[model samples]
Target: MEELIKRVEELEKNTQKSSRERELLLNRICELEDLVEDLTLQLKKSKKTIRTPVAPKESLAINNASKKTNAQEDEPWLFYCPKNKPYEEILRNLDFSEGYEITSSALVSEEALWTQILEKMNEEEIPKKLTALRKLVSVQLSSACHHELLIIVRGIPGNENPLFQLILPHIATLAEYVNIAWSEVENSNPELLGRIALVLECEQDLKVLSVDRGDTRLSLYVEKLL
Candidate 1:
């Protein structure tokens, strides 16, 4: 009976030890699976971070070049018309109208004279010639006597009076066709339409007018209105 009892106790001890070992192995397997899942999640996040896009250096360079080109194209000139000279002399002596011809000049053409006048208005220094240029534009508009005038106005850098207020009433009058020749203009060339629109917009008035771009014969009439 004593021997049988001792044998039964030994068997129970052996069974308990095996169960403990199995439990330890199962815990270790669970820990390893958790580590693998964490590692996979970290790898996926790293790949996503790496895949994010960055702007190319060449694209940045191209954008900068485009801005520079636009700046150069919009560069403004200075006005230099004097009151003491003949209309032809004022047109000729001014640096802005150096090569421009008055006889063949259209009312609204982008000739040297017109460019000079616009440059003067756009200059940073606000030269004394601005007054003369303004008068010139006003006189030209008055002489052409077109009912509907379109003016394109662009502000000059560093200018306090950048708005096209100086030519507003005249432009407005032209738009209404109150004093100018509306019939002849309607029958004339259409190419002057764009220039006329620009002039009208430049004035910055809240008025609307129609211009035809197809007529080339009215260019002379448009020039006179300029």
Candidate 2:
């Protein structure tokens, strides 16, 4: 009887030990799995960081290139009349580096010459000349003409004859001539029609008999005896 009891107790102890060993092995396996998952995540993050590190110099270069491109695109070239000798001389005399305003008389003379030149520009040269003149003169002439013509029309007290009267007839003829030239200009380049419109708008009082862009036209603005 005593031997049987001892044998049973030994058997129980052995079974408990085996169960404890199995539990310990499962806990160790779980810990190892957790460690592998953590290592894999760390490795992926390290590879990503190595592959595409941000470069300060490269970023600065890209920014500078973009700024340079923008500046080039925005900048417009200065323009001048190649045909008018006086205008050419005036432009040559101008010290653009000094940044000075051109004399009113000089600007007026240039405007008059440009008005005359516009009449002579044929189909082939109209586009080039108009583009050039827009950059040089058209941008400045509107306000200048208004102020100058007003001053001339309302002469100073000392002047015997108003300056406008002397030029009025010539101005009338020029207006008619401009109307004809603008028609040709419109036919050649419709884009420049706005410039003609601007001139007409600036000198609104000047009579424009007709702007016949399609065919033959005439201006009654010129003084006539009927």
Candidate 3:
């Protein structure tokens, strides 16, 4: 009988030990699962951080090149026309009937001048087109007036002085972009002259050339780009 009792006690102790070991194994398994979850989260976060920088770096490189190219383009020679009365409307109504005969030696036909101006205006860039247009006008005016062809500005003064000098490398840089100039535009639209006046009034950097500041406010000239 004592042997049987001893056997029963030993069996109970073994069962208790087995139970404890099973509980410990379960706790360890739980700990391992938690560790796996934490590792997975960390990996996802690391992947996100790694991917963030590459895209911006390429974008920055491209932007720098574009900016550099833009910086190299030519700037316009701004000239201030001094006149008590704004000649914006008058300039628009100029009849090229007399033709460009400002010089005694030669005469330039209006059709020839118009053809040249139109060719120059046929540019992809709006600023280049405008610059070309301004140049053409300057050429015609210089020829018509019998003066050394210089930069020209014909516009009415605005009510308020310009606060900031806007240097538009392209017409795209302007507040408004108008792809409205061509041979037809010059022929029918007298407002074309007013368009230039509008640009002068709106943008800055039209540098006034050192020309004769006379009573006649018909045109303004500069010896060279200041």
Candidate 4:
């Protein structure tokens, strides 16, 4: 009877020990699960933080470039009469060069030049848009009795002014661009529609060169583009 009692006590102690061990193991498993959840949450937060700045930073560049390339697409130059920009327009206002302004035919804008360049090309591709930009033939006509038109068409490096990015490298190819300028001038001024006289700018003086189309034609002795 004593031996049976001892066996019972031993069995009870072993069962208690096993129960404590199981409880400890369960606690450990719960701790591991909590750690895994915390780690997963941290990983998600980290991904969000990384994407916030990186994505917009890349997209901003493309957005700016597209805006610049396609700026004032609905307006094209008819005729800008200014031979030189005003002091306030030129002097330290480099911003004036990039942020071009345009106004409708009812009136002109602060930056009236861009209005004459591009007019409605939302469907054009980038290269075609640039081609349209390069094809600008600047012709300035005076309203006086003397019908003299100044043609200022040249392709400058894109850095100086984004607008006048011309491509006339050789002197021989000048007449083609001149014809383009002539057409623009004719359309703008109805008086010079029939014909005009060429008062060529020679040195500091004006020299008259005759070209007949019914009236007088004025040709400027164009200087070497600096």
lDDT per residue for candidate 3 within 1-226, as digits (tens), equals 9999999999999987975675465556556766898999998888745444442221111111111111243222222334322344324333112211111011133333333333333422121233333444444432322211121222323335331212221211111111122212334542333222112322223333111213322222211211
User: In candidate 4, residue 170 scores what lDDT?
Assistant: 18
lDDT of model 2 at position 16: 78
Candidate 4 structure quality by residue, lDDT tens digits, 102-182 = 222212221222223233212111122222223322222222112322223222223243332222121112332334454
| lDDT for predicted candidate 1 compared with the true structure | 0.33
Give candidate 4's error at residue 59 in angstroms.
38
User: lDDT tens digits, residues 25-104, model 2?
Assistant: 54565567668989999988887455666533321111101111112332111122222224223333432111112221
lDDT for model 2, please: 0.33
Worst 10-residue lDDT window, candidate 4: 60-69
Question: For model 1, how does the per-residue alpha-carbon lDDT over 1-226 read when each residue is reduced to its tens digit?
Answer: 9999999999988887875675455456556766898999998888745555764433111111111111233211112121222434433332222222221112233233344443433432222332333434444444332322323332211213433333333333333331233223324532231112222112222223223323311111121111
Prediction 3 global C-alpha lDDT: 0.31
Determine the backbone clash count of candidate 2: 0
> TM-score of each candidate?
0.21, 0.22, 0.22, 0.22
